[model samples]
Target: MASPHRKGSNIEGILDVKRDKVTVSPLGLDITWGGDSRYWRIDARYVELIQVCWLEVNGSVEMKHLEKSTKYKLEFKIRMKPDAFGWNDSPVYIMAMPGKKAKCIWASVDLSRIKKSEQESSLIPPRLEFTTPGPESFHEDDRMSFGLFEIWKGRWKGGLVIEGVIISRA
Candidate 1:
């Protein structure tokens, strides 16, 4: 069973859900920014993905005066350690107007660049990563906005994680 807990103005994490071949762990995330403002930033990260799963989220806020023709950009940062076989995979998705029947739009960021090699002495890099997916139109009556990165596949030699957001503004 997947159970989610809420704290204050933020939803904490999902619990009792299956991951990595039936292993259960809480997928709690710290939402650095989210609200009814003209702009929003959503971020999250995880180190495991070994099963078929999906994250479902909805908005309880309504937007008024949102400019027509405006566009929303979604970005994601996913980091993971390579499994013993050294491989990882995930898909980022954006649902137009949260929970709508429209097809999910995949983020345009290239996954091949995710595994860039950096100097060992350099600062530690954030595992999973992304910026808001971009260049899409918005309507005045479009009150709902939400985004997510589905961990479609992940297997590697060490560890893995990713982070990113859907930023909406005029």
Candidate 2:
């Protein structure tokens, strides 16, 4: 569901890794997700974690779709439900690599910092910044693979809503 939309004078490129397009570990059995009427207007689907000890959500975007030589940031748009648990001390890592041969870059963020509210509200998630390779260094088929992970904790966690991953100019 990634698309380029027009900005005032320039096109602000964006890549949206929607729930359907993301690869979720332990899908269906422990995690349930799909489109809902509430998000119909924005054309967004949501992934909810029922219960899981290992967590990993991954997605990627093609470099050709982005403006060359420009810096971009990637973020996972997520929210924690009121009854969410097991994230008190768990630190999730956000990772990204410009291309298959590139070294991976990652940053850790504490999801427990997000305040749980009665309403479904979005939180300012952690971001990983990367610069698109210049034309001479870029390849048409190159891709930027990214993911959110909390696999080592091995503690049961639930009530997490994954809206999607957003990649935009930094």
Candidate 3:
């Protein structure tokens, strides 16, 4: 993976979200719910099958972290394995922002089709995006936040490799 974009109009490479950086919820608990940490070809050594209801990874960049007045995207870096099960019909959830009132949104991955096609995970990965405040509106502690959470859709989810999440200029 490459470093993040540093300028307003720059096209940045992937800002990888490594496995060791994940911050699981419930305090003091690890994110060993349905999957394990391992290496994959997509990116680096990361976690997988993170199907827990509160599985999350939180990260914040420094002041002027991204280019001012640029549009950036938050992507959930993951892969679909052949025996990977679940996650086809079920919707995944994500929450980003700096405060508690952040709205949760639904997301999905159709890896079943990818398995049949044997396509590279990099070709397409689930992601979310938001526009950065222009230089005028830029403020201190303006962090970009996002993560995948379990939905209350009344079923368990499994079968996905989470190499990391990335934020880059769009």
Cα error, candidate 2, residue 100 (Å) = 1.0
Listing every candidate in turn, what is its Cα RMSD in Å to the true structure after a full C-alpha superposition? Answer: 12.9, 9.6, 10.1
Give residue 20's lDDT in candidate 3 (0 to 100).
Answer: 23
Tens-digit lDDT string for candidate 1 (24-115): 11133322222211212223333233322333222222223223344433333344333312333443343334223224444333333455
Q: Give the top-scoring candidate (lDDT).
A: 2
lDDT scores in order: 0.30, 0.62, 0.44
Residue 96 lDDT in candidate 1: 36
Give stretches of model 3 more than 4 Å off.
1-44, 50-59, 95-119, 123-127
Q: Give the worst 10-residue stretch by lDDT in candidate 2.
A: 2-11
TM-score of each: 0.36, 0.72, 0.57
Query: Per-residue lDDT tens digits of candidate 3, residues 1-170?
Result: 52321111112332323332322121211233322323111222444553433333444443245565555555555566565655566555554453223343334544455552133454223455555566566665655555555545555555566655556655
The numbered model that scores best in TM-score is 2
Q: Any runs in candidate 1 off by more than 4 Å, and if so which?
A: 1-66, 82-94, 98-104, 107-113, 116-143, 149-160, 168-170
